[model samples]
Target chain A: SSHATGYNSNRILAPYSVYKGKAAFSLTPSLPTFTKLHSGAVVVDRRGSIMVIFMHAIGDRKYDWENRQRFALSATEVGSLLTMGPQDSCEFFHDPSIKSSNAGQVRKSLSIKPHANSNGYFMNLTVVNNLLNTKEFFSVPVTAAEFAVMKTACSFALPHIMGWDKMTHQQSTGGTVGLQS
Target chain B: SSHATGYNSNRILAPYSVYKGKAAFSLTPSLPTFTKLHSGAVVVDRRGSIMVIFMHAIGDRKYDWENRQRFALSATEVGSLLTMGPQDSCEFFHDPSIKSSNAGQVRKSLSIKPHANSNGYFMNLTVVNNLLNTKEFFSVPVTAAEFAVMKTACSFALPHIMGWDKMTHQQSTGGTVGLQS
Candidate 1:
């Protein structure tokens, strides 16, 4: 129970700092200065050195899923947001209104249309997050077609991974999942 | 390139020793004492402090996919197997012929029928590996229904995990997976 609780807490609490030279970011608004955002959940990347936190607000926990503007913030930007307080809104946009003297230095952000399905929203959020976070963005822009392909790939990979985990667990526990021993 | 190579090598080389107080096990037969067997791979469980190695023969790395008899070996049994030289064959079974007077003391093992599909085999292998490695196995037996659900959950979790990794990697490399600035 401790292990399970600990694992769950770790998953929900903050960004896992498994690798060195990376800044640790907290997802939960536990700090005194921190205020709760509209985002229901925050996802952290554990596989790589650069930690990414994807935050999106889902208005209600049950039924009526409405996604607010999603923000993909760096460690420094996150810290700034925390200090700015919850009352002040911080919007990330790729709009021309947000101008820079040098066009090359302009920051461009991606936006995903809100979906009625939670699964669709999660998948799209993941795809867009991946696209924005990748180094390839500087060289190649993610097209709508590529986004669709990535989403499809993520959808496909999900079942395989789960199936593998389930079968493995069943074997370990000596339980039959329709597989003859 | 280093990251990709490292990740691939880690996946194929040895069982991940993510927990403490568990014996480290190698899946590959790189040891001089190791004898090439018909089995394809081995899976280890971290929670129960047990290790199971499944071996299958790929033959010429092209066509032949013969499934050898699957064996689930404990840590002590694994040690004994390692001590076994290439000239000797290690046989693991729950055969009644190999009798032990004390039934309770007898080590139990699970077996799976051979599948023609490599993807199925790999998925099963991964599932079993994770099941054996988790902390929950010490307390609860994973049920067939639970296994199905867990597999489904894992399936969904995989793409998110992979997508996060890809994004993190791209960000680290400063390459675009296609977000315009």
Candidate 2:
């Protein structure tokens, strides 16, 4: 069965002597990659910083020697791929660590065409499209100066971001990811 | 103003001689070519015998100058192109001398993707994925012998076929080229 997957992240906390101690914690947060490999074609594009809730994308990635690819599909198209039938719920994945405490966060539109072949799907702690949204979250523990540098370097090296999570149960806030049998 | 367009036919015709006489004709058809000029990405396929129906895929060639090199929609994404509004009537160039009356009596499925670039989107009579369906009345006449040769040639030339159409009409049951304004 195709299941959601993710990657690892690491950061060093520099030493800054406080009056009595060094104040700080550097984020080496675990992030998710935009696309994981299956041998086909890969198209990557980054939209401006903005959040989206309009369309929902659900997927299954099973590792099999014979099968290696992700077929792009819209929500409706994915529904057709459903073998469990309508109304059935299944476990799925979503990266919520970056979700804004407020829903108004504009995560710029970022889309990628991950086909059957790819070297490796990489990810950072932020969404590639919305530099602003990524900054807002990064600035929480990191300084503006540190955020800027990290964003740029990480983006160039690891552009694809978003951890894959498993959805055990889904509530119809508007859309659902899994099919329940 | 109308000129370059292509047709995709999904039907069965009797192009064989012996039992058929005059008015029956068959022309060896070619495969269609699909490509996006900007990307230089190309794909090709083949299909059954298609009646070429038009005589002047010229003016439908949309251009103010002879220096033009391609169609506006050709090799472009459909989302960027206008949605094919309701148009039942279309125009095609007819060359009866080509004589393809009893063209393909065999079962055939023709599919054409509109030339997003050129005005006259005459389909290159190829098998492809973009095709939705086609009309019957507007087909060109071809002989049964010609149909056989055409089909065999098409099957052989599958890879060379570029998905292109010189006709510019949506297939429909209505005999009219388009609805009256």
Candidate 3:
């Protein structure tokens, strides 16, 4: 708890000056600011860095059923009003608004690593928040067309993504992924 | 903001005096303590009650790579490992550890949801995290075997669930879903 006297980019630094003392020789920066420091015995690129999340929302817990899936717990229920929620499958995507003038359209992507280990066959059909009392509502069914698009996208997809519960691969692209070694 | 100074779950209960509350229903025996909780939520079968989460470390940050992908960050550098890190595709199957005590295979089923969004063309690799540091490390070109399996599964698997992304009347299925359904 004792202060190390005058600080050098660290010590009493505002938030993340990222300075180390005589005993420490390594620095792992989570933010963009600390990338310049290289003081420690830690190997370069050896430790896993924290990823910056940009998707609007990942793995929405939505109801996959028609407009009816939102209200009741089961799809086969009374008439409903709210829209179903998103799926449990994890997703990664970029917001058009968040795009920098430099990145171009490169960052627009979504990935869902859903909890495929449960009975929520159609992840999009599974509700995350109760959704009954809020404005957040979306849906994705394993059998829905968009879901099929996602399914095909996941299956025959360029990187060959996997789906819940099976060996199925999603491939919805009209062409092939071009990459060499 | 207020408290009834008597019996509380966390604190010690009195020896003889019984504690009563305004709420009619109470924990019968008492709620079992859990170690962890998920960031998201999932509704129960029919009841308004939501399912509780305990072991959530596995799927902690699965697709949490969206924003990070903007800088074209690689998976090898990230902290903590992903399930099926950067494989062309991840194979899905039941853990096979649990036995017949469970009925629906969903309880035992497991699969990887591969990540590959090409921005609609010329997909990029190295952003996926299927299983960090394993044979699946870094993305690979989709293989012939994977291609064959996906094509067969998509083309002939479920005609009922195809070709509906850009149209109106969504695809529908009546009976239970089979392999491709």
List DockQ for all candidates: 0.03, 0.01, 0.01
lDDT agreement of model 1 with the native: 0.28
Higher-ranked by DockQ: 1 or 3: 1
Q: Tell me what fraction of the real C-alpha contacts between chains A and B each candidate also makes.
A: 0.06, 0.00, 0.00
When summed lDDT is taken over every stretch of 10 residues in candidate 1 chain B, the lowest stretch is: B24-33
Best by DockQ: 1
Question: In the order shown, what is each candidate's alpha-carbon RMSD?
Answer: 23.4, 25.1, 29.2
- For all predicted structures, in order, the TM-scores are 0.19, 0.18, 0.17
Q: Find the candidate with the highest lDDT and give its number.
A: 1
Candidate 3, B79-103: lDDT as tens digits = 0111123432332222222464432
Write the residue-wise lDDT of candidate 1 on B71-131 in tens digits: 3343344444334321333434443224555433333344222224321111122212222
Candidate 2's C-alpha runs over 4 A off are: A1-72, A78-181, B1-22, B25-29, B32-88, B93-181
Q: Rank the candidates by lDDT, best first.
A: 1, 2, 3
Which docking class does model 1 fall in? incorrect
Give the runs in model 1 whose Cα sits over 4 Å from its true position: A1-114, A117-119, A122-152, A155-181, B1-11, B14-104, B107-137, B140-181
Rank by TM-score, highest first.
Answer: 1, 2, 3
Per-residue CA lDDT of model 2 for B55-145, tens digit only, reads: 2123443222232111111111111111122221122222222344533322222222333443222222221121334332212233334
Question: Model 3 chain B, poorest ten-residue lDDT window?
Answer: B22-31
